[model samples]
Target: MLGDELIALLGDRIPDDHARQWLADRWVPRFYATRPGGARVVDLGCGIGESLDLFRAHDPAVRWVGVDLEDSPEVRERTRGDAEFLTFDGAAIPLPDASVDLVYSKQVFEHVERPRPLLADVARVLRPGGWFCGSLSQMEPYHSLSVGGYTPSGWTTVVEETGLRVVELRPGIDAAALLVRRLLGMPAFADRWFAGTSPLHRALRRHPRLRGGGPRVHNAARLMVSGQFAFLARRPED
Candidate 1:
């Protein structure tokens, strides 16, 4: 599929709901909470390892693995032996095929110079029915060696090419809000990012049409203008 056909096909996968509460960027914590105990979860581009705390708080039974280009003193200091840490060459995940139950990433894909190899590796590591979920940059400005952002169509094409199915896509903060935050050089404004109370979202909340339009209408409007997006995809069951 190509062009509008592919876009329409992917659009169908987005869920419809009444509250539009899923627009919140809280998927990481919620995802951790919902997993059955003992789920093998991988943190792709684990950074200084903040997510481990969520695992500890939400689902202690998760077998956590942190993957990055190399280990750091901060990561070692923060995470210690609580979870295994591994390094990668940006092309492959070291885990065996079908070994991971869930792979979670956040604001990391934009740094990836090439995504296919790592994504294919994501597909390789995920067990049948396993999920890959994370947020990606869209209209945000450059930061921390940023490479590029992704549109909904761009995400669908790249992720689906790796044999994972795109299940849901939700918008994040508004583009203008994100850029203004960056321009003002204020970290305090960062709180709005995943907090789900960004300026545009606040405005949309009061809009009568969005208030009553249901999830599909709300999300379609939001995704068109958001600065970031989160996705949930699965490796099909064998």
Candidate 2:
């Protein structure tokens, strides 16, 4: 994801209309292009299921499955209308090998104790040439379960080590908004409170001083503020 406009909140956080727009404008357009027609999609660590719901709305013919450690009513209610829910044992996924056309995750990598095994399992489920893309924290504040913080370089190493080729890796930030937040001494608040569509926010981020250097300067600011990393990767076709 590039530019401030492409930065998106998850479906669980945003309103349904915004979620739909995110799928139409961001998610579907990028992820769907790599998979075949009627591709099977599975989301690992799907928290409340709204992301899958939005994806389903866009492509009804695709098979949608959401997997997590616990299957709770809240998740069930959120996902029941459009998708199937499954719970896993925190290790091996229950699905058949090579059965999924795309496997997606977001903000879930840090808690994975055995990241290689997790990626191996993800690779197992994906068809050759299929995609697995998600966002993860590069430098976020620690929560109880938070155990890893990875740089873009670290992600490239981990994914390739697990047999997935990196396609795109970039900073996750509303660049201008984050800078404003940093200046206001409330970087954390900006993540939750910044206006996603503010013209000034977009303009400041697109300014020459920052935009001209490409992601180098953009990501430097992101890392200082504990921003995130967004990656799109694939299982090898061979």
Candidate 3:
């Protein structure tokens, strides 16, 4: 179980629609709004650079860098010519201190075996007042395609311990719902259920609804029952 087999395994387990929505609505907008022109942004554990893609879409002027261990062919194909994607160890990013304005990661923290070093690296690379925006799966099944694992409270604790300020912590989709869907062998059902049959789907296609406070309230209710977590943090000004 390595390479493509591993990537496929993890990808299959994650709810695709939920992940995409998080990136487009939650993560991208949150970070990109803070960036000034020509700001350097690094997407740590970029996984195929989808998050980077979202950042690029938000602001094509911003410089984007993506780092990941498993640069799968699909990821390579998707990220080609859009931004810089590099293969590197997640714990030890290959960038100089205070070189970037933001470091964004999505669903990458739980898998870290030793999070301290990773946080140190993040603190090392980010400039004062730079943001480290991301999300982690706290209450989800144990599935890995890349070389990592999950841990609840780990991301928050690491940021605090490593001297980063906790800016905002938002609850994500329902993990229990996802688990049930997986258990029932129908992961896509929840998305269809939430989306319903609307002409909007034809326009957006596969992209999930990235707006509406109403949907967030409804999704939070579902998550309360399902048990999943997500958050965003930042490095303080010295």
Model 1: per-residue Cα lDDT over 1-238, one tens digit each: 1123433656666567532424323666666555678889899988887788776676777788989877444445654666788888877999999999889988889888879999999999999988898888889898877899998778888999999998888777778788888888857857656565577766776776655565666676677677887789999999
Question: Please, what are the lDDT tens digits per residue for candidate 3 over residues 66-173?
Answer: 887765444556536567877766588999999989888777766666678988899889999888876666566665643443332344556778888665444444
Number of backbone collisions per candidate, in order? Answer: 0, 0, 4
Error of 1 at 33 (Å): 6.8
TM-scores, all models, native as reference: 0.86, 0.70, 0.69
If ranked by TM-score, best first, what sequence of candidates would result? 1, 2, 3
Per residue, candidate 2 scores C-alpha lDDT tens digits across 1-238 of 3323222311111122211001112545566665556778888877687667567666768788888777444444553545687888667888998999878787778777778887889988898988887777765556437787786666777788878877655445533443566577765656553324323434545666655544444443333333455667888888
- Residue 146 in model 2: shift from native, Å? 2.4
Q: How accurate locally is residue 78 in candidate 1, as Cα lDDT from 0 to 100?
A: 57
Q: How accurate is candidate 1 locally (lDDT)?
A: 0.77
Collision count of model 2 = 0
- Runs of candidate 1 with Cα error greater than 4 angstroms are 1-9, 18-25, 28-35, 71-81, 205-212
Model 2 regions more than 4 Å off: 1-25, 34-36, 71-82, 174-226
lDDT of each: 0.77, 0.62, 0.59
Candidate 2 lDDT at 60 equals: 68
Point out the worst 10-residue segment of candidate 3 by lDDT: 1-10
